[model samples]
Target chain A: MKTAIDIENVSFAYNEQPVIRNVSMTIESGDFLGLIGPNGSGKTTLLKIMLGLQLPDSGSVELFGTPANEFAEGTRLGYVSQHSTDADSMMRVTVREVVEMGRYPHAGLRRLTDKDHQIIDDALKTVEIEEYADRRISNLSGGQRQRAYIARALASEADLLALDEPTVGVDADVVDQFYELLTELNAEGITIVLIEHDIAKVSEYAETMACLDGELYEHSATSEFLKSGALERAFSSARAVSSRSVTRGD
Target chain B: MATETTRQRRELGAVALGIPLVLLAFIVFVVWVFPPLFELFWNGMEQLFNEHWLVSSSFLQHGFTAGVLIGFTAPVVGSYLVNRQMALIGEALAHTAFGGVAIGLFVGASIPVLNYPLLWALVVAAIAALGMQYIAVNTDGYADIPIAIMLTGGFAVGIAVISYGVVFSATVESYLFGDILFVPFENVQLMVGLTLLVGLVVGLTHKQLKFITFDREAARLARINVWLYDTLLIVLTALVVVAAMQILGAILVAGMLVIPVAAAMQVTNSFNRGMLISIVFGQIAVIGGILSSYYLGIATGPMIILVAIGIYLLAIVR
Candidate 1:
């Protein structure tokens, strides 16, 4: 019955051009929500508002019953940004060091304690990346790197995890495994919110769906929404390419 | 498994022995062999410590004063510069400060001594630095152009002022090359006071600066004042530039700010670790360069920078 995120009549614009208009939605705790829309349909922008990374011009957002701005430090929120890149070239830090950054809000200015190290190790283990703990992040494959990033989020002990197209550059096998991991985490009561374009595949993993179209189009149970042809319309405008056939008729 | 353990043990033993051997050799070289080989070295060093205390204290005062001020302030400003990928802005500001110093000299301000005239010159330099940032932000596809223009223009101004000087009593060479030996007591006191003020500001605003540096949009969304932190960073940079100019000279000041930080970033994964490494590496450069300069009779600032660059190169090679 606890609401994790609440947004009310939110609108956003960039350079005076509207991107999101009068949108409102509430996500409850333990919900696995998938946001689906075509490219540039304001899915990412809406997520940004939820993450408190961007402001809505005319509305308000609250996380865990507190105003977004008034949330206390060390509140369990995890974010994996689209623009997160490998650290600068001059750095030669290992995977362990990068994951340790997630502990920063909890342990300010002090060295990592034994408990922090245990959390980091456990997070790495949860991501199945304990083997790569000592390896440099740059040397890892794209899938491995993404897993490292997930470990960083896991290390934060976050109650809510927000990912922006986490499967963008990953291979099919890794993507499948990543979804499995997400489901496992969801089973453990961590709320998951993700913006994904692979609507057909993601519907199996996500329990709830929010279809965005410059506004909040629909928010309903994922299976029920898909059965009602919601996703078909969201991605219905794909252009088909025709191919000529030479057969026995000729 | 037993063989593997033994092999590891041997490697560890080698490291333990190798480190001590190197330290022993260095101690012997510093204490025993070098004194008689360079006879005048000990006498000059003795005189430097004895007669130069008044002057050394002044220089120490200057170095510590400037070091403490810049050490605390530049890093806060640097947090933004690193995030913005505008690290070169510090270099441009140093050059602009050079121009301010030239104009101050041409107007009959004392060159070697710290005075109100030099302070006003620093203010002009700070304004110029801010102006350059504005231009860079407003222009499209030419982020580095404004900085490049300021650098060249500032140097040209310095040249013109030096050529048209009325009567030159102090050699301009010392300022350009940096003569830490000439630092007076008053300058030292001023340096220390300024550094403390900068430190307090940085400490108080640490979280705000970090938020803006890592994610500006998020900082804005959280309703944390972005412009206030941005302006504070630039002003702090300008103050650090003026303070460091005495020890490293105008042309070389930016090197000290950037090189150690760059090196630290090479080996650390976290921002906090990078900062700690940078301070440690910077101190090493300062101490090593000073000792080498005193022994070899070379320029102190360049020596320090060379040591830092050497560390950077070693990190790269490894």
Candidate 2:
């Protein structure tokens, strides 16, 4: 299997205190990788470093074999941020317009061609939100908005998808649906790197798991992870009990 | 759009209705008590709407052409500013242009070689915009910090120059509120060129500008230079504001940049359509204001803005 992401001995600091210290992890291609931790556990920071949105104080990130800083193939990697709506809602734009923005990186020499439209429509169909394509984005529900974002990621036609707390403001039921959609996409041969705080949801869909608490605790198969109690060190006792119960049920 | 309701159409009608009422008021005022202050175009009043084509007088020709050019460019660029919530940038640069006006007047009085205050206003406004962008980058203040600083600083320098009466007092009012009728052919030619430049730049970069305004981070991620687009937008605004100051007045310049977009926003659901509506509304405001001020003896700047305010009121009721 190809190595999709290689994060090496990375440490980042805010002011003086370290937020991410000596953390390293690797994601193999075709793996559904879930990264879970407590609040401020540097999960988002790690994702940012990989996407070149943030630089680590030490060590490095390699995306699909190229150094993150020198990686010029950004179009081959799809990213969905948490604050996607905040800046976008300022303009009066439709869902189709937002999804079309994904093609901008690859829109060379010509405007959106017939092939591009087919892909965009397929992305919408994949997310099952095709009916809302012409509606203004601000008019959609939270789940619908996430579906639109996922469609944008799909439209990029990248093999790897990186999500940063994508289910942040979603309800419990909606989160289940979101994870199920991720599982379906993962089964369809896309490598997914999901940064989530919901341990229950992450355990249900992630084939491989990494526990982080400002430091890497373990990276192993989900079955091996569940056999051990690595989450105990990362989460509080109450959360550990509920998360264990949720994972055991899965 | 099919979604455009009857209420919206009626609200737009309210806006259209204001122009004729204003025109009637001017007509009654002209017939009631003829003011010699407008002895410039009192004759051939019957051709007031289409009189610019007649070229009946040089003043009317210059005034009408300048006003129409300003009408189009202000909203073309203003739509982006309003969407980005940077409408105050226009107000800031207009005041900064006043400082340029003061410098030109003083220098012209001393040297008698540099006599165009509007040209100086353009230079100062452009530099001030770039300088403010620089300060915004180096300072810890918010995005609007430079605009706020330039606004007060520019006005202070302009007011001080005039108060000192250092060759800036006698000709200050024309620059302050605009003297569109008295514009030289050279300045009118410059306005034409500036207006065309604004139109061309905006037309060429419309999608990129919209992308930056909509999502700067995403645009950056897509390899679009957000900084370059931001600078281009601000510089274009500087050009538009300086050209408009002499026709729209420095104090009222923000009105042209904001109110028409606001009115358009109330009616249109998309940014492109909103911009188109804004340009049309700006034309009505400028043209109607010019005709009213000519007939009723009022400052063209205030007259245009008052008509804009009436349009805003009509939009608000929707």
Candidate 3:
């Protein structure tokens, strides 16, 4: 199987403190990979490195067999940031315009072509937001906005889609729906890397899971890792805090 | 459903009629009332276009040439200025350019050889603009300190230059008040050429500019040469200010750069649409203001700027 992402000895630091230490991981094509960690545990930073939006101090990232730096412009890579709210506040751009930006890498310096419009339409339909295509993006609720972003990513025709905390701020039912949408996309052979905080949801949705805390801890099939108590070991402190709270309540 | 359809029809009807009514009013003012009003203003319009014409013997050509030149250029650079939140910097640069004009007057009187005083003034103003940008970027503590100092200090120098001698007081007043009647053919050509150049540069570099404005960190990560683009924008702004100051004067040029874009932003949903609307609004303000100023025998630049501000107010209220 072709490797979708390869990270070797990747490390990052702000000032003197290391955020991510010499971590190495590989994701195969068509894998629904979930990266989970505590807040400030370098999950987003690692994803940025893969997106070529940040430089790693000690190692390299290769996406689609090309070094991250050498990846061609307009290469099929889609990213949905945690701060998608920022895009929400500034403009009353329609859902279609936001998705149209996904085609920007390919449509550089040229007006959007018919094919681009068709792709955007297809993406909106695929994410089931076609009815809201002409609606102002700011008018959409949080769940609807999240789905709109998903459509934007889908419109890129990207072979690899990286989402940082896609389920944050979304209601539980919507979160499940979002996961179902991702599962359908994955089944269609698109590689997805989801950065998430909820261990239960990540385990439920991802085929492969990696628990990171300044370093990689467990990397294995989600079902086997859960059966082996690997997740509990990685999140023992969190579990302890939660159980203590439950006992106090009782 | 019937009510909704009726409401949509009414709204569409209003827009369709409103656009044509505005156009008609503009035409009536320009054609029917403007010529008689021009005759009443001590023949300033006649002088602007006739034998004493600053450029040539065509009043309509001269007014429109000046109007279109200011209309096209200001908003192109103004769009970026609004996006960067550097509208105040344009104001400071205008004040600094005024100092340059004062220096030009002083030098022109002292030396028997210097002929193109405005050129010297623009050069000094451009230098001051670039110097302020450098200080603002390099200084650590306060962002507005450098601008405040430059604006006040430059104006003080201008006052000193004026007090030192009285050789070109009338010309200085024209510079301060902005006499569109005095705009020569050569200056009109220059303004038109610079406007086109700046507009083309902006069109080519729109992506880089938008990227930097939208997300500086992302732009830096993309190896976009942020500092280079920032300085390029500053220099472009300086050039636009110098060109615009010739018609609008130093004191009022910044208003033209800012108010139209601000008004357009209130109504438009996207950056490109905002820019286009701003240019359209700017032209309306200039043309209307000039005709009114000619009729009332008042200074042209402030009148135009005030008209633009009025449009902004109306847009907000609406």
Candidate 4:
């Protein structure tokens, strides 16, 4: 299998404070990899670095054999960030309009063709949100909104989908359905890298799991990863450091 | 699939060739065609209204023409700016254009050919816009901090330049507070060129602009050249501001950019629809303001703004 993402010794800092420290990993094509870490453990930062949304302070990342920062075929990758749901924004855009953005990378200074519209419609149908195509994005429920985003990714014809905390405010039943959708997409040979807080839920769905706490603790098949005890170590150490910092601040 | 690829290639080739050709054609239209076309429009309006002085008088004709063009262009560009929470950037650019006008006047008194204050205003406002975009992207702190600085700093520079004995004529006050009757035929022509240019550019880039405005992060990830679009939108705003400065004045110019869009947002659930509605509301405000100014002896700029505000209140209640 081809490598979808390759990160080597990548270190990142915000205001000189390191967020991701020498993190190294490789995500294979069509792999469903679950990246789980505590809040502020740099999962989001690592995802961004891999996507070339942010440059690392040190080391490097590659997407499909090209250096990530130089990778310009953006239509091949779809990203759903933590703030993907613009619930608070007053931007009055329809769901169809939002989905139409998926075609923008392909359209590029030209009008959308009938073929593009067909692709958009197919994506909307794939996500089962065809009924809400004309509704304002803000008017949708959280799960419905997430489905719209996934449809956008589908419309882009993205081979790699990176989702960060995609189910933050979703209900439990809907979250299950959402994960099932991810599994279906992954089975369809689209590579997925998900950042979720729920360890068991991720482990059940992900073929591989990686534990992170400013650094990679372990990365392996889901069964081996669960048996590795890396999660306990990473979480416990993070607790110790955070408590220590709290005391020092006081 | 092969046919699709071929078709797309053809489209791409057309676009590659089309943009420069379209811009060149628009320039030709503006230069050789628009003045006569505008004269014909006014002549028709005059005859349609039985040669009423409001339509026939050259002063009202120029003012009304300029006002209507501003009505269409400002709100169209403003839709993106307002939705992006960069509304005040328009105000800041207007102030910078004011400074440019002062410098242009000061310099023109010395040199004979460089007397077009609006031209100077365009140059200064465009530069200031790029500078603000740079600062907003590179520097820390809220986006508005730089905007606020540009706002006051620009006005301060204008005041200083004007105080330096730069023949502060009623023309300066007209640019400051806006005087509809003060528009010249040449300036009206400038507004027509600007309106067409703005309309063309916005029409071409509406998808990119709307995408970025609705979601900046997703736009950047999609390799939409977020920074380039940001610069383009701000520069367009500067163009609109400078063009509007003649009739709306610097202080009131931002109102035209902001008010119509705000009202449209209150009524519509789709961004594209909101843009269209805002343009309609802008036309209403401009026409209503011109008529009110004629009958009630009020300032055209303020009356336009007030009419827009009235529409906004009505929209909110609805």
Candidate 5:
């Protein structure tokens, strides 16, 4: 199988404070990899690096064989950030307009054609938000807004989808539906890299799982990962360190 | 269902009216397909008004033409800036342009050939815009810090230049407090050219600009060259500021960029529709202010801004 993302000894620091240290992993094409960790495990930063949104302080990243810094095919990648739903509340944009942004990378400088419109419609339909297409994005519920973002990804025809805590503010039932949609898309041969705080929930949908606590603890199939106690080790290790700091403070 | 049908019909009506006008604007401004379109428009206005002095006089003609073009270009560019919460950038650029004008006047006192203050304003404003963009991107402080610095720093420079050179206070005051009667025919033509450049640039890069305005991180992820587009937008704002400074003055110029879009946003949910409506509102303000200023014998700059504020209040009330 072709590799979707290849990270080799990637290390990143914020103001000389290392956040990601000697972390390395490879995501194969069509893999639904759920990356779970405690808060500030550098999961989001790693995702951004993989998507070429940031540069690593050391080592390298490759997206589909090209160096991450040099990778320019934006059309093949779709990113739904953690703050996506809440960031543009003041913007007066319709759902269809938000979805149409997916096609922007495809139709640079030229007007959207009939085929582009058709793809956008298909994307909206896929997310089942065609009914709300004309409505203002700000007026939509959190669940509906996420669907709009997913539809945008669909419209872009992106083979790889990267989401950072995409269901943070969503309701419980809506989160399940959102993951089911991810599952369906993954089955349709799209590669998904998702960072979710809910470990059990992500493990249920993800075929592969990776745990990170400043560094990679484990990367394996979800079933094996659950049995291997890597999640517990990663979490307990962080807890141990925090408790040690507390004891020292006393 | 009835409301839905009405909304659809209204949308269709807007599209129908919009397409022709957009095509006309592109042809007239971008391609210069019909250089006589303005003459035809003025002649029609003169004939309709029975050869009134306001419509027949060449000074008023040039002033009105310049006003209408500023009305068109300012709000279109302002839509992006306002939505991005960078509305004050216009104010900053205008102040920098004022500085440039002061320098131009000082230099022109010695050299007759380099007397075009607007030309100098364009150069200084564009450079300051790029400098502002660089600082905003590279620094890690409050976004408004650079804006405040530019705003005050540019004004200080202008004041220093004016005081040192002993430039004519009357000539400087016209630019500071905009005189509609001061616009020349060549400036009107320059307005047309600026309008064309703005229209073409916005038309081509609307998607990129819209995407960046709504979400900077996503635009970067899309490899849309967020820095380049941000720079492009700031430069465009500078160009519009220089073009608009002739009629709106340094103080009120940002009003032409902010107020119309603010009012339009109050009424519409779609950015594209809001942009179109803002242009409509801008035209109304320009025309209303010019006519009111003519009759009331008030300053056209403040008159236009007050008209725009009135529209905003009305939109809010609605």
Candidate 6:
């Protein structure tokens, strides 16, 4: 099987405080990876490293057999970050324009072609936001705005979607719809790597789970994570409570 | 989405905001600066006009050109800087250019080989602009701290040169507070070229710039070079700041960059519309300020800024 990501003994720090400590992990192609940890356990930092936004202090990351630093084909991967909605309100472009920005990487000194426009419209329809295509993004609801960002990522036509807390500030009812949309996209076979603080929540969608507590245990399946005491040893009290909440009906 | 009626109303509001500039310019030119001089030079100008047809006084020509170009260019770039919430950087770079002006003056006095104050200002201001970004990135200081440091550091150097008596221009007080009296035709040509370059580059990269400003991290994720665009935006800002100093002056160019864009935002619904409206407001400020300065014998920079403020107040009310 082709490996989608290969991280080797990576460690990182900020202002002399260590974050990711000698963590190694591999995510195979087509695997939905759920990276979960405590609030300060550096899940977002790790995600940033995987996407080449920030370089790790030591060790290396290989994306699709190319080193993260040398990976020239960034359009092959899509990313949605936290606070994306906040930036949306400051800009005055329409939702369609916002989604079309995803084509910039491929457009490359030329205007969008018919195929690019078709892809953008398709992405918006996939996210069910074709209604607000002409409307400014500032007018959209939080969930709808997030969908716009997803449409932006989707418009890139990437094979891998790496989202950092996509549902952090969104309301609960919308979050279910958001996750359902993700599942639908996953059903279409795009690989997903989602970062979350709660293992229980992400375990619902992720087949493979990595519990990071300054270090990584990447090979645990969701079923083993629930049955084994491995999570109790690696996580803080918050995860323990969330773990109980997830296992209650089971 | 704004309906057609609302859009028409918004455009009307922008034009209305622009009306006072016309009145102020009319009062300044017809009432004050040109009364005695217009009488003395009217026949000479008319005869020259008959021969050359475009014959105008260097002052009027330079002032008119500077006012219009600054009007068109300042707010286009200013809108991006304002939307990014980096308005202070504009102020800082102007001071850097001011220091450059001082350096140019001093060098011309001591060396006599080099003498263009405006060109020197551009060079130093560009360096200072890039330096501020460098300081902000390489150091642990706050973002605004680098700006604050550059702001005062550049001005402190300028003040020191003035105090040393090496760079003070006693006759050209207009250089201190902005005046059209001393602007040579050659300098107007420079402003014209600079305006064209700034306008062209900005027009080409506007969409990419919009993306970078909207969400830098997302832009980076999508393979946009965030650092390159950020540097480009700041460097372009430095160029505009240098270009605007002829009318708004160094002490007051920030007003041109910020106020017009602020006022325009109140009247328009979208980014591109707001930017277009901002250029209109900026033109009003410049034309009105130049006219008033010529007639009333007031400082042009302050006059322009005050007009912009009044327009801003009116925009808020509407």
Which DockQ-derived CAPRI band holds candidate 3? Answer: incorrect
lDDT of 3 by residue, A197-223 (tens): 888888898999888766787778998
DockQ of 6: 0.21
lDDT by residue (tens digit), candidate 4, B153-250: 99998889999955767979999999988898778878877888788778777888988888777777877777877999999999999988888899
lDDT tens digits, residue span A1-250, model 1: 7999999999887766677889999999999999887666678888877866666887998888876655553227777656554232224447786677566445532346999999999999999999988877677776777787778777878888888888877898888898999999999999999888888778989999988766777789997887777666655532111121211100
For each candidate, the DockQ is: 0.19, 0.17, 0.13, 0.43, 0.31, 0.21
The alpha-carbon deviation from the true structure for residue B259 of candidate 5, after best TM-score superposition, in angstroms, is 0.6
Worst 10 residues of 4 chain A by lDDT: A241-250
- Minimal lDDT window, size 10, model 4 chain B: B1-10
lDDT of 1: 0.68
Ranking by DockQ: 4, 5, 6, 1, 2, 3
Better of 3 and 5 by TM-score: 5
Off by over 4 Å in 2: A84-87, A108-119, A236-250, B1-55, B163-165, B168-170
Candidate 5 docking class? acceptable
Please report, as a residue range, the 10-residue window in candidate 2 chain A with the lowest summed lDDT.
A241-250
| Interface RMSD list for the candidates | 16.0, 13.1, 15.2, 6.0, 12.1, 12.2
Question: What is the model-wide C-alpha lDDT for candidate 4?
Answer: 0.88
Off by over 4 Å in 3: A84-88, A227-250, B1-64, B92-177, B205-232
- For DockQ, candidate 2 versus 5, the one ahead is 5
Query: Clashes per prediction?
Result: 4, 0, 0, 0, 0, 2
For candidate 1, give the DockQ: 0.19
Every candidate's lDDT = 0.68, 0.78, 0.73, 0.88, 0.88, 0.77
Best-fitting candidate, measured by DockQ?
Answer: 4
User: What is the Å distance of residue A221 in model 5 from its true position?
Assistant: 0.5
Candidate 2 residue A45 Cα shift, in angstroms, is 1.9
Model 2 clashing residue pairs (backbone): none
